[model samples]
Target chain A: MRAFRAQAAAELRLTARRGDAVLLNLAIPVGLLVFFSLVDVLPRPAHVAHAVTFLTPGILALAVMSTSMVSLGIATGFERQYGVLKRLGATPLGRPRLLAAKIASIAVIEIFQVIVLVAVAFAVGWNPSGPVWLAVPAVLLGTAAFAGLGLLMAGALRAEVTLAAANGLYLALLLLGGMIFPLSKLPGGMRDFARALPAGALSDALHGSLAAGGGVPGRAWVVLALWAVAAPVAAARLFRWE
Target chain B: MHRSDHPAISVSGLVVRYGDVVAVDGLDLHAEAGQVLGLLGRNGAGKTSTVEALEGYRRAAAGRLEVLGLDPQRPDDRTRLARRVGVMLQSGGVYPAMAPGEALRLFASYYDDPVAPSALLERLGLEDVARTPWRRLSGGEQQRLSLALALVGRPEVVFLDEPTAGVDPHGRVAIRAEVARLKAGGVCVVLTTHELEEAERLADRIVIIEKGSVVAAGTPAELTSEGGDAAARGGTGAGGGAGVAGVAGMRFGAPPGLDTAALAAVLGAAVEEIEPGQYRVADPGRPATVAALAGWLAERDLPLADLRTGRERLEEVFLRLTAGDRGGAREEEGR
Candidate 1:
């Protein structure tokens, strides 16, 4: 347990030291959210009184996308390439502990990411109508599902392949996850596919709570819960240390 | 630090295959604590494969193996065995963005009880660069930092794969000295190298691996004595006492040229001219070989031009043993 904590701390420090990752993961997402809300180039629905309310949940989903997929995939892939994972594998720090540390550090960064994006969302004009506490479990579940998928991509592919694939996944999630645009605007087939995605489910739940003035459905919560449980189990079974 | 009476590592009939390349064949080997075992071999001689298998990084296709009394090849047993062993793999690289001290501390965290980073850096002569990032350090400094990380776990056994491969002479001396200190501290060290002097200076016993089996292994003296005996029976056996000279033979190069009669007079019968240009110089006290030879040669004004000496050096022993063995064939073909 002590070794796990130490390793987690070290991983967090290393992650924070990466200037570009912070810029891309934390800074860029918030910047885009604010910039898009200020300009009306992209059409907005007339009934939507404040675009910030609609934009807030999408921006939060973007935060999850950057950290859980892009950051986790690229960093872990490089760690395996450098033999860092191999070194850790050979220590008293067993696989379980090493994995726990990775998850813990990512969780820590996600909390900070959430806080910064939420603050920016409020300043831009988002006003919460339902219980804000509901977003906690929703964000936690989203992080797990996405991080697990990221690990699967990282552990099974070459670092170069992971880099290309992760970027592709990021762009697809941005479009189909309904983070930048409304899923109702998509064609019928694409909207059904997007709704099944964990990102889309998470965005729907958050948007219902703070933006749409509708209650978050039990069905959407179930999808998020199923993904939270399944993706990590898959990652744990198949993840490669080196 | 258990006091169990067992070899630190024991292997029997180990085999590993990568596709069609059988990296390690049926081989039996072991190393005890408090001794430095040198694994000497040519490239692709299965040295790395064997070591990786022992470290649990590579699974053996067939073998009965025990590292620190645990079967590392077993999937469930690997983590238990890893806790006790430290590995400095050749492929492991430093995080170039991390400071030296930070990197050491990070690796140190992997063990329950680890050596302090400050002390390790001081011992490795890495104090000046402790605050420097990995990319800013020189190649030798990076190598030393790697050594420091290996020692951080305070491991009972350490595996060093080509620790001095690209290091300078001075760094090599320091690394060897540190290894000697580790031996004195009762750590079992397995060092793989192609350098003969490294084996001679650091290994209490050397194992010569050819293709995947142990071709020769023993204390340095025992291996060298075999050379002396072979020289005694070779073509120049007429120089009976020349066997004792045992200066390691040269196959293609011109032999040393020193006046034997003049050398014999200088040493007062201690030096005997057993054959032309080949003199048997004996020092009962085991005086420095070169300095005494030079003094004796100078006293007689003998042009010590090409006085070829013939005793088996470790390199000759290695080359002779491994030169003919095929990569996959296990049966020995030559003496």
Candidate 2:
């Protein structure tokens, strides 16, 4: 366990050192959150309810998308191309620990992402009532769902394929994921597909916990759990640790 | 039961096929303890496939293989064998992003007992680049790092596939010295290379595999003698089926008088008797002829001259033996 943790820490440290990881996973999400909240480009209610409240969880979801999918896809794809997976495969560290370490590091990064987003939300006068505890499970579930799907995309596809697919997925999920707009506002097919997509499910779950005050059991929560379960198993079966 | 005189690694009728072309065909090899067995073959002469099969990396199509007294095909047994075996592949590249020392340490964690990274690095002259990332290291440095990774585990049997493939003369000498060190330490080293000089300097026994089978098998002197033209020109019918014929082409300076009768019986009458104390057998098709000749001479206390077989360097020897087949094999494997 100590060895696994050390490896996990090392992987995380390496990721942190990469300039692009910081720019994409941290800076981009935070910058976008601040930019979207300040800008009047979106249809607003005269700045009364404040756009930051609705935008905070969505920005948090975007951060999750970038880290769990885009960043992981790019890093793992390069690792594969460079024979990092082959080197590790020869060792005693099996697939389970390798994946576990990657997931754990992302979870750690997600914590920092959440804290920063929440700080920005509070600065913008965003407040929540009736128990903040529910938000923790929602965030955890959201993380797991997106991370699992990200690993699947990273492992199964070719590096070039993953890069293009991950970028395309990230952009599409951003707009249709209920992060920028409510799902009901999207077209019929897109709304239905987004409901099933892990990113959309994560964004919906987070919005429910933070804004809806834990009043309703959201379909997004169930969707997130199901995907979280499926993507990991599929990755395990299909992942090529070249 | 006490440890019998079993081969360190044994493979019989081993075959490996990728699609239509067979990479390894009915190959047989055995390396005993306390000796370095040089597996000399050309590129695509089934060297990598044979090594991979023995290392339990590639599944064999048909063969019985025992590595370190355990079947390599069994997953549990193979893992156990792997723990005791050090394998240096020709192309298993290190992580470019990792420092040399860091990479060594990471690999060290896999084995239960590994030599200290500092000591290994120092031995391989990699101490200067210990902190350097793998990509920054030169070709020789990279080769040394690869060798260090192979030996760090302190395994009983080390299979080195082209240890000096891309190394310069200095690095080659260093690697040869390391192989000598391993041999002195009582490690059974299975070395594969295209350079026959490396084999001559290091191998206690050299086996040349061509077209997926053993083309020649014996010591440097033995192989050269068997492959020499001495027996072919004489046509003396000295010893026919002896293992010596496979490598009877290169004959070294002869020793004193050796008994011809017993030698004939051992080498099987196809050997052409040269002058006193010398015998030449030429049969490229036989793998047992050289052993037969050696047994005949050994049975009657006769001193044999220095013998050479195959090419002086494994690469030349491999080219001479398997060049014809590799061209077609390479073309087929390209797709």
Candidate 3:
């Protein structure tokens, strides 16, 4: 337990110190939230009354995925390459605790991301009507799903490959996974594929809970739950220490 | 059942294979508590593979291996033994963004009882750069920080791979002193190094591996003496007469074209002009032999430039052992 805390603290320090991590996980997400909310840019969906109202939930979802998946995955890949993972593997901290600490640090970072994005959204004249209680499960499940995928890529691929692949996936999911624009905006086949993706499911769940005022969507919950469980299990089974 | 009674490390018939190529082949080694076991080998001779297997970083292809009397590969043993063993890898175990103090503290937290991080840094001469990021530190500084991390855990058995490789001479002395301290504290150390002087100075026992097998194993004194004896007997082996020529001969400098036969008859040992104005007395340690040589030089008014008795150095022994078997294995495979 002591080792876990120390490892998590170290991970957080390292993440906070890196300029790129700040840009990707915290700055960019908040920047997107402010940019899209203030500008009349995105084509609002038929059911949505205000652009800020619709985009807020999606931006929050984007915050979760960016911090937990893209940034975490690339950083972990480099950690593995640099032998930090191997060093921890030889310690009493072990693999499981090392992973738990990484997850905990990601969750802590996500909390900060949530606070800043929500504060920014409120300032932009956004109002969320749905039971805000549902957002908790959506954010936690979304973080798990994305963090799992991130660790899987970090562990299985080379650092350079993981870096390129993570960036590519983040962009693809941002456009097609209903973060910036709704699934209705994507083409027919892409909408179906997007719904199956964890990114899309998370966005749908957050949007349903926050903007639409309907309880968390049942289908989004199921999709996200499946991803949350499967990705982490697969990552655990496949990860290589070195 | 006592931990102190068991060998700190024990390996029997250990084998490690990468694809079809066998790296460590039927190797056996042991290191006792408080002993510094120097593992010496040529490139690709399986030293790293053997150390990795023992450290639980690599799986053994075959045979038995135990660290601190427990199987290193077993999950339960891995967790239990981790606290008891510390490993310093060849490179890259620290995050580049982390400060040296932070990295040390993080690793120190892994053990129930650990050396203080600040003290370790100070001892390793890293106090000045305690807050410096790993990538920003010089290569020698990074190496010292790695060493500090390994020792912070207060491990019972430590495996250091090239611990002084890039360290400056001053840093090297500090590291050697720390290693000596570890030995005094009853920490078993197994180090692999290219520096023969380090091995001779620190190791209580030395093992030289060739082609995945130990070709020579003994104390520094014993190995050097063996090489000296071999040379004295005129045996033509690897490193044959290379540096060992000093072991069986008395080297002295004087005018060339001397009457060596007359000198040999008087000294009761063969005397030969080995180089221009240089002479070798076959056995010069005897008082009579030295007296006769000095008397002869004094009588001839020949000024003696230099004189010394022969004792083979460790390098001669290492080269003789490793060099002799290099081609023998390949030729056998070809045949």
Candidate 4:
């Protein structure tokens, strides 16, 4: 437990110190929340009254994905390339502890992201119609699902390839996963496909909890749970220390 | 769990393969506590593979390998073994963004009881770079940082792979001193290096591996003395009693065509004219041998130039052991 805490603290320090990670996980989400809310670019959904109210949940979902999946994946991939993971394998902390530390650091970063994004949303006159506390499960589940995929890529691919893939995936999910605009904006087949994805499920859950003041949807929870369980198991089986 | 009589490290018939190519084949070696075992080899000689396997970083295809009397290849033994064993890899064990102090502290936390990070940093002369990120550190500084990380846990057995590779002369001296200290603390150290002088000064026993197998293993004195034995033996058949020179023998300049038989009789050991004007006395440490050589030179009015005893150097022995295998195509890759 002590070793885990030390490893997590060191990991968090590195994550916070890295300029690219900070930009991707924190700055970008806040920027999107302020920009999209003020610019009026998002086509308002029929049930939503204001763009900021709709974007708050989407922005929060994007924050969770960016921090847990894209940023974490790219960082882990480079750590493997640099032989950090291999060295840790030789330490008393062991593999499980190292993974725990990484997950813990991701959770800490997500918490910071949430606090900052929510503060910015409130500053922009956003009001929640749904039970805002329900966003907790949505964010936690989203983080787990995305963190699993991130680690899988980081462990399985080269650092440069993971970098490109992570960024590309982030953009694809942002545009097509119903985070920036509703699934209603997409055509019928695409909407169904997007809804089936963890990214879409995360956005839907966050929207239900924060925007509509409703409980998390059961389907969204199921999709996130499946991804959360499957992605990490796959990553563990495939991950190489060196 | 503790076996006091067992070797600190033991390997028998160890084999490591990268696909079809063999990196280490049928290799066997051991080191005891408080001893420094220098593993000298040419590039691709399987030195790194052997060390990595013992550190539990690589799986051996076939072998019984043990460190601290525990099987490193077993996953269940790793956590316990890691606490007692510290490994300094050839490169890249630290996070690039982490500061030296932070790296030390983080690694130290893995042990139940650890050396203080601040003290270790000071001891390694890294106090100046405590806050410097790993990527910004100089090569030598980075190497020292790696060493400090390996030592911070107070391990019982340490495997250092070229610990002073990029270090400056002063830093090298400091590292050597630290290694000596580790030995004094009863830590078994297994180090690999291309530097013969470093090995000579540090290793209690030296093992030279060639083509993934040990070609020679002995104390520094023993290996070098073997070269002297070869020279002495080679001359014995030709000069009879006139060429039985050991490593302590002295050579001096003399006039050409001087009578060596008389000198051999006077010294009571082999005395021979190895070159045109150079006379060698087989045992210069003997009072009579030095006296006879000096008296012979004075009587002949011969001026001795380059008069020095023949002490075989470790470099010569190492080259002789590893000579034929140099510049060959690598038998395997992926160390």
Candidate 5:
């Protein structure tokens, strides 16, 4: 337990110190939220009374994915390449603890992301309704889904390949996830594909609580739960240390 | 069993294979507590593979390995093995942004009782650069920091992978001192290095390996003299094996292809021109033998350059042993 805490703390310290991590994980989603809310650039989804109402929830989902999946994956990929994972594995802080530490640190960063994004959303003239606490479970499930996918890629591929694939997937999900544009805006097949994706499911789930007319999102919950469970199990079974 | 009775590290018929490449082949080695064993082999000679298998990072294809009396390969003993063993990889295991101070403190946290991070920094002469990030530190400083991390856990056994390979002279001295200090504390150390002199200075026993198996194992003194007399009198079988047999021979520059058979007759020992214009008298034992060589060369009107005669240097013995591995010691084989 002590080794786990130290590893997590060290991982967090390094992540906080990295310039790209700060920009990608914290600045991008928050910056995009503020930018679109004030700029009147969004296509404006149907029945969304305030632009901030829709944008805030979607951006929070983006923020969670950015930190939990994309950022974590890239960092772990490089760590493996540098042999840091290998070295730490040889210590009392074994491989299982090392992984748990990374997830713990990512969870911590996500909490901060939520507080900042939510605060900014409130400042930008948005009103959340209908079980706002439900967003908490939604965010945690989304974090697990993305984290597992991120680790799956980072563990199975080379660092350079992971970097390219993760960034590519992040952009693809950003447009398809209804963060800026709803899935309805995408073409027929593309719309269905986006809805099936974890990012899209996460965005829709967050929208159920943080946006008006919020209610239980049964379909989105099912999608998030499947990915939350499946991706992690796959990553655990297939991840290679070297 | 008592600590002295059970060796700190024991391996028998160890084999490590990567696909079709056999890295460690039927190797055996043992080291008692407080012993420093130098594993000497060229690049791709399986030194790292052997160490990795012992460290439990790589699974052995065959044979038994025990460290601190625990089988490293057993999953049940992983945490136990980790707590007892500290490993220093060759390079680049640290996070690029982590400073030496942070790395030391973080790794120290893994053990029950660790050496103070600050004290380890001071011991390794890394105090000045403690705040500097790992990638920004000099190569030598990075190496010292690696060593410091290995020692921080206060492990009973330590495995160092070329600890001084790229270090500067001053850093090398500091690392050597730390290794000596570890031995003084009764810690068992197994370090892999191609640096022959470092082995001579630090290793209680040196194991020279080639093709994933030990070719020679002895104290530096014993190895230098092991094959000497046998090699002189038409001994040693086949290509390029141990040179610089026990006693020292006078090697002086002269005409290539000297009549060595006649010279050996006169000196009552073996003589050969190991290289063009370089002659080796296998048993240049007495003061009179030295005079005889000069007199022999003078009578033949042959010029002599440097006459170096003493106990054979470890370097000479090392070259002879490894030369065979390269398949280029035909001259030594012919005689």
Candidate 6:
């Protein structure tokens, strides 16, 4: 446990030191929420009075994806490339504990992201009528799913490839997952495709359980739960130390 | 730190394969606690693979490998075995952004009782770069920090891959001292390096491997001495003091294209300009031959460069063994 904490602290310091990752994971999500909320380019959400109400939930979900997947995966890929993972694997901490530490650090960064995004959302006239606490499970599940994918990508692919894939996927999910636009706006087939993705499920789950909607949709929760389990299992089975 | 009656590491018939490449083939290695076993080999001679297999980073295709009586190759035993072993990788095993101080502290946390990070920093001569990031540190500093990370856990056994490979003279001294300290503290140190001097200075016993198997292993004194019993018993009888040309020879570099025929006539011995700027006397065991060569060199005013004598016979022994290995390796590849 002591090893886990030390490793977690080390991983967090490395993650935080990366200027590009911070810009992608923390700044971009916050920037998107604030910029889109102030602009009228986005279609007014069906039931929500202001766009901030709709954007807030999806923005939080996006934050989870960026921190859990893009930031964590790219960093892990490079660390593995540089033989850091192999070195840690040789230690008494072992791979399982090292992995636990990495996820723990991701969770720590997610908390900071939440506090910042929520404070900004509140300042932009966003108030919730439905259960806001549901976002907790919603965010946690999203984090697990994305974090697993991140590790899977990092452990299985080359560092350069992971960098490109993580960034490319982040953009695709941002534009297609209803984080910036409504799922209803994506054409029929495209909307279904977007909804089938974990990013989409996370966006819907957060949107439904936040102030803009009442109660969580069964399908969104089920999709998230399936992904939350599948991605991590795949990552665990396929992850390599070197 | 735990006392064990048996050797710290024991291995026999170890086979490690990377697809078609047999990296460690039928290799045998053993080291008791408090012993420094120097593993010497040329590039691609399976030193790294052997170390990795023992360290539990690579699975042996076939063999019995025990570290502290635990088989590191077994998945179930890896972590348990890891608790008692420290490994220093060849390069870049640390986060580029992490400082030596932070890395040592992090690695120290893994053990129930770890050496203080500050103590390690001071010992490895890394105090000035304790706060510097790994990427920013000089190559020698990076190596010293890597060594410090391995020792921070106070492991009972340590595997250091080229610990002093690119280190400066001071860094090399620090590493050698720490290795000696580890030996005194009853820790087994298995070091693989191309630095022959390090092996000669630090290893109580040295094993030289080629094509995945040990060709010669004995104390440095035994291997380097021309009449040492190890040469008589060394595998394949390649150890017949056969260097450059078979038998005792004096080799030196002077001007290229020396008059070998005239020099041989003067010494009444076989002499040859083996390559550009390099000459060899077939039998330097005769002082008359030495005098004749010196006279000939004096007549030519040719300055000798790196003229080695008995001090470097381990290198002579190594050259003899690996010389045969190169031909065999090429034949195997050709086939």
- Interface C-alpha root-mean-square deviation, candidates in order: 1.7, 2.8, 0.8, 0.8, 0.9, 0.8
For each candidate, what TM-score against the reference? 0.84, 0.79, 0.87, 0.86, 0.93, 0.91
| Runs with alpha carbons beyond 4 Å of true place in candidate 4 | A131-133, A213-218, B1-3, B227-309, B325-334
lDDT of each: 0.74, 0.71, 0.83, 0.83, 0.84, 0.84
Once fitted onto the true fold, the runs of candidate 1 whose alpha carbons sit more than 4 angstroms away are A44-47, A217-219, B227-252, B255-307, B325-335
Model 4 C-alpha lDDT per residue in residues A1-242, reported as the tens digit of each score: 88999999988988889898999988888998899999997886787888898898898899899989998999999999998888888888988788889889988988888889889999999888777787887788888889989999999999999999999999999987777798778989998888888899999999888876456779888998888888888988898768
Q: In model 5, what lDDT does residue B6 have? A: 60
TM-score of chain B of each: 0.75, 0.71, 0.79, 0.78, 0.88, 0.84
Chain A TM-score values, per prediction? 0.92, 0.90, 0.96, 0.96, 0.96, 0.97
lDDT of 3 by residue, A152-213 (tens): 99999999999999999999999988888888788898888999999999999988889765
Q: Give candidate 2's chain B TM-score.
A: 0.71
DockQ, candidate 6, comes to 0.85
Better of 1 and 4 by DockQ: 4
lDDT per residue for candidate 3 within B1-335, as digits (tens), equals: 13556789999989887777777778888888889999876666778888888888878999999888899978888888888888888787999998899998999888888899999988999989999999999888988888888888888899888888888988898889888999998999999886789898889988776667766677877666624343221222223233332244576889999999999998989998977898888884677788889999999999899887755567756765566545543211100
Question: B1-335, model 4: which lDDT tens digit per residue?
Answer: 23367789999989888887778877888899999999887678888888998988878999999887789999988777888888898998899989899899999889888999999999999999999999999989998999999998888899999888889987898799889999998899999987889888889988777667776677888767734443222211112223222255676776777778887787787877866997667774566666767887788788767666656567756665565525663545434
What are the runs in model 5 whose C-alpha is more than 4 Å off?
B1-5, B226-247, B261-268, B295-303, B325-335
In candidate 2, how many Å is residue A128 off?
3.8
- Model 3: DockQ vs. true structure: 0.69
CA displacement after TM-score superposition, residue A122 of candidate 1 (Å): 1.8
Worst 10 residues of 3 chain B by lDDT: B231-240
| Candidate 1 CAPRI grade | acceptable
What DockQ would you assign to candidate 4?
0.68
Instruction: Give candidate 6 regions above 4 Å deviation.
Output: A212-214, B229-289, B292-312, B324-335
DockQ, all models: 0.48, 0.23, 0.69, 0.68, 0.85, 0.85
Candidate 2 deviant stretches above 4 angstroms: A43-48, A129-131, A213-217, B1-7, B226-317, B323-326, B331-335
Whichever of 4 and 6 has more DockQ, that candidate is 6
